[model samples]
Target: MLNSNMLRKLDMQDLMVFVAVYEQSSVTEVSEALCVSQSTVSYCLKKLRTSFENELFVNTRSGMLPTSKATAMYPHILSILKIINTCHSGIPAFDPTQKEITFNVCAPEYFELLILPKLVKRFIGSRFPVIINITKFHRDIPADELMEGRFDLVICFGPNFHRGVKGLRSQVLLEDELVCVVDKNFTLAEEAFSLETFVACQHVFPTPWTSDTNMIDGWLARQGYNRQIVARANSYVAALNMIAGTDFILTLPRRIQALTCDENTFSHRRPPAGLPNFTLDMMWSEKPSQDSANSWFREQIIKVCAEDGLL
Candidate 1:
C-alpha cells in the first residue's frame, strides 16, 4: 500500500527498525539492540506504519504479533535489507579475475617457504591478476604500520604488538612446535638429546638482525638455564649451515626446518623439555574488512591454511 513518494522517503535506518521490531517483537528490545532510545524505535515504527497505511503489529498476550499485512510483506523487506547490507559491505559486482589489485605483505623467510607457495598458486590458477609484494619482517617496523596502510598485511611469529593501538586485528595462521636440528653425523643424532645435553651442547642460535637474543634464549634465561652459543646467524638457513657436519645444533620451528632441510644431511628431533610452541599470525588493518577484494583475499588465505592443516 506504499506510494512511490513514500517509498522514496524511506531510508535504511527505517527498514532496520522495521526488521528489528518484526524479529524481536518489542520496541524496548529493538532499542537495546540498536543502541537507540525507545522513543526512536517507536517513532520509526509509527512512520513505517503511516507509510504502509497499516498498523504493522498488534500487542497481544503472547507478544507484539505482526498483523496480516506486515506478515505478508516481511519476506520482501528482508530481501531488500540483505541487498542493502551487501552494497554497504563492498562493491556489488566484484570480479577478481577481471580486476587487478596489488596487496603488500611483510613476512619472514619461514613464511616464504611454507605459506607463499599455496597462496600464489591459488591466485594464479584463478587468473586473479593480482600482485602480492612480500618483504622481510623487521623489528624496527612498528606493528601499527598495518593500520596506517604502510602494508596491507603482515605475517610473523609472536608479534610484539604495541598496546593501545586501535583498529588492528590478527589471526593465527599456523602452529608449530620447536625442534632441534643437527647434522646427521652429529653423535647425538643417533640417540635422544637429553635436557642436560641440550644445555651442555654448543648451539648455533638464529637471532633476529635487530635483537641480541631469540625466543629460546629468552625462555632459557627465565628458567636459569643457558646454552653455549658458539655462533649466531640471522636466518634459519644460515643457522642450519652453521650446524651441518658439526657438533652444533640449531633449535627452530619444526615445520620450517622440515620443509627447508635436506633429510639426508640433517636430522630433527623434538626440542628438550621447556621449549615452547609458536604460532604464525596474520595481522592487518581493520579498514580492509569492508573491502570485497581484500575480504576475498583473506578468505583465500584462511581456506588454504585450513585445507592444508596449517591451522
Candidate 2:
C-alpha cells in the first residue's frame, strides 16, 4: 500500500514510463516512445519501483518481462492514464479539418478489399489530413487492448466480436452471405445447386480465415452433411489459381468473391439454402470521457459503407 508521501513522489511521467516499459518491455524502447532519455526513463522506473515496493519488471533473455506485481498493476495504471488523458483533452472540441490526427484501426483483409478503398477515397477527397493505421484482426478483440488505446476501432465478423467484453461498443456495418465460386467449365450435377452436388465437389478452403470446422462445416454438421475439402490456400488469389481449370469449389463471402474472382475464369453461384449470413461490425472502447473525434471517424466509416451499398 502506497502512502500519501509515496503517491506524491509518483508523477504522471512515472506512470507513463511504467506503462510503456510494461508494454514494450524495454527501457530504451520506452524512452524512445516517450521521447525521453534512457536515464530519465530509468529514473522514473526507479521512482515507480520505490513507490510501489516492487521490481515490476525483470530482464530476461527474451525481453524485459513484467513481474506478477506489474501485471496486476497494469490495468489500474492504464485506467489512470486514460482518465488523465480524457480530463486533459476531452473538453476541446475535435475538428478533423483543423489539425492532423491519427487513428489506428484493426480489421481483417475482407475490410481492406471492400471498405478501405472507399474510406480512403472519402478522406482524400475531404482533405482531412488524418492518418489511418490498419492492423490485422486476430481471433478475438481483447478488452484490455482497446482500453489501453492500442486500437481506436475494430472491424470484424459478427462471431469474432465478443459481446461480453465490457467498456466496448459495436454496431453492425453490413451483412453478407457466402457464395460458391468454381471454374467456368465446372457443371452442377443437379438442375439446381443442391446439397448433394455441393458436397460431391472437391473444395478449396481458404486457410486462417476458414477451415473445415468453420461456420460452413458447423452448419453442415447440424444437418448431418459434410463437404469434401481437398486443398487449403492462404489467400483468395492462390485459391483462385488452384481452382482454375480444376473442379474445386471455394466458398467465401459474396463481397469478397466479387472483388477477387474474374468473370472470364470463374463463376459464382448462390450457396446452398439455409446458409447463415454474417455481419461485419465496427467496435470501439467507450471511455469515461467521450471525444467527438471518435464519433466523427465512426460516421465516416458508416457513410462509406452506406454509399457502397454495403449497409
Q: Per-residue CA lDDT of candidate 2, range 118-220, in tens?
A: 8888889989889989877665675677788888888877856244687888899999989989889886644236787788889998753422246788788
| Model 2 weakest lDDT span, ten residues long | 206-215
Per-residue C-alpha lDDT of model 1 across residues 83-199, encoded as one tens digit per residue: 877778845545787768898888877777787899899889878888989877776444566767778887777645223346768788888888888888888644456777888
Best by lDDT, which number?
2
- For model 1, state the Cα shift of residue 162 in Å: 7.1
Q: Whole-model lDDT, candidate 1?
A: 0.79
TM-score of each candidate structure, all chains considered together:
0.69, 0.65
Superposed by TM-score, candidate 2 places the C-alpha of residue 173 at a distance from the truth, in angstroms, of 0.4
Model 2 residue-pair collision total: 0
Clashing residue pairs for model 2: none
- Report per-prediction Cα RMSD to one decimal: 10.5, 16.3
